[model samples]
Target: MSRTIPFHFVDVFAVAPLTGNSLAVVDGGGELALELMQNIAREFNQSETTFVLPATRPDADWKLRSFTPKGVEVFGAGGHNTLGAWWWLAAAGRLELGDGPTRFHQQIGDLVYPLAIWQSQGKLEKIIMRQEAPVAGRQLSNLGALATALGLNAEEIAADVVPCQVVSTGAAHLLVPIRDRQAVDRISPDAKQLFDLLNEVGGEGCYVFSLDPLQPGTTAYARFFNPTVGISEDPATGTAAGPLAAHLVAHGLAQPGVIKVEQGTTLGRTSIIEVGVDAGSVSVSGRGIVVASGAFSI
Candidate 1:
């Protein structure tokens, strides 16, 4: 028998209540089937919907399963899916917090990560996610071809600042650099072309960046386009931001330290993503706000 399933909506990596990327979180997934969760995700149609379940392994505190509206399973080594749920639980007083920062573990697939929750006065202030160690993948040799695919002039592709390369902290993304903010603002990509190009290069999507940021404190301005998994543009992408930080450090564009990034302004929903790099590991953290919640019965 179909039952009413309760889900929460959160603005992940948000600066304000309504901004940042949106997500739907379903708790108590141990009794729910994978197919049911996928159908729920399709019904929600958010960027992602995450299901929280009791941890099957002794090492992990909880289990998370994330899906796109298209029912595509998103890799969850580190991203907003896990963060949003954890944030909701901690903020709602569902998770136990002993009056200070608490450490826990979460598992997605074969990877288990250390999760830190900071709660002040029974409200979640922020979540610090330690992503997988950075993996510097292939640098695109065919910048001209990539430019054509992204609808950018070959000259506008900031080859001098840093070459567009494939990088992954967990999920793979092609990081492209534009010379200036004006160049970044003018991008109009053929979705099909960009999607096909990324698929061929082993990336889930591409993150176009500009060193010329809108604000002085932010290190870069960026936009994410992913058609392979049905996302045309993401407001904020923690998955891509981690890799972008590592890519910048590898190319000497930014020092090996905490770098702030601005995204989603062009789309009206502005978001700030923080990236921390030391040695080879990258940490991404941000704030999430609970926007809405409801129950859906099928």
Candidate 2:
């Protein structure tokens, strides 16, 4: 007999549903094989999906596995997945508001998600998560060859943002800072070339940002593309945001504190991601809403 498993679809980093990046959560996925998890994620066709399993250790909180629609397992973490999993657990009554720091054992290592709920207008709000410290990688050369790989004019890139580098909080990405927002909005990457270059250099994807550091409230306008991983465009990318914030601070582009990043404008799904970096450690946080929940038998 086949048993049905309940799942949730959550929009992460958006105040309203369908505005932020969506993730599908399978609450008890320990019994499923890696191939099965990848198949389910591809069937859902989201940018990313998560599988949650019970923790083996008594002091552990939860074990999670993340997958892209193309069946590739992701290491480290994604901002939306962390929030989506917690929201599903809390809403299902498996986790309580006072559960302290919920631990997540991922392929990367141990990740702690501290839950916090607040009452506003007599309604309960879900907890927001702060990501762990980011790990920085080697700074690659920002030569003309790299620009060609991205289908961008070498002259269009900002001269001041030297050493077009690869950075990672948990996931590695190419940090490409453009001269202006026009380049960011207009340029389209040669997905195949970009992916090949990233893999050759041991990076996951590329993040392009137009610097507008002088803006009062906004820090930068950015876009992320990962065709190699089957994400044409991300509505809101929390994993990239953390390193972007660090890049901004390291390059003297913005003040070292909290800054707001706007993404998905060209895609018609506007989303805001907030990040904080201090002393080389980065933390990304955002609000998410549960759009739909249901069960499926496999």
Best by TM-score: 1
Tens-place lDDT per residue, model 1, 31-101, is 88779888989988988999988888899988888999888988755577878888888877777886467
Segments of candidate 2 deviating more than 4 angstroms: 98-132, 213-216
What TM-score does candidate 1 get on C-alpha atoms? 0.96
The global C-alpha lDDT for each of the candidates, from Candidate 1 onward, is 0.86, 0.73
Ten residues in sequence with the least summed lDDT for candidate 2: 99-108
TM-score, prediction 2:
0.87
lDDT of 2 by residue, 184-276 (tens): 888777778777777766777778888663335778888888876888878778788888888778878888888788887777666778788
lDDT of 1 at 236: 91
Model 1 has an lDDT value of: 0.86
RMSD of model 2 against the true structure: 3.1
Model 2: lDDT equals 0.73
In model 1, pairs of residues that clash are none
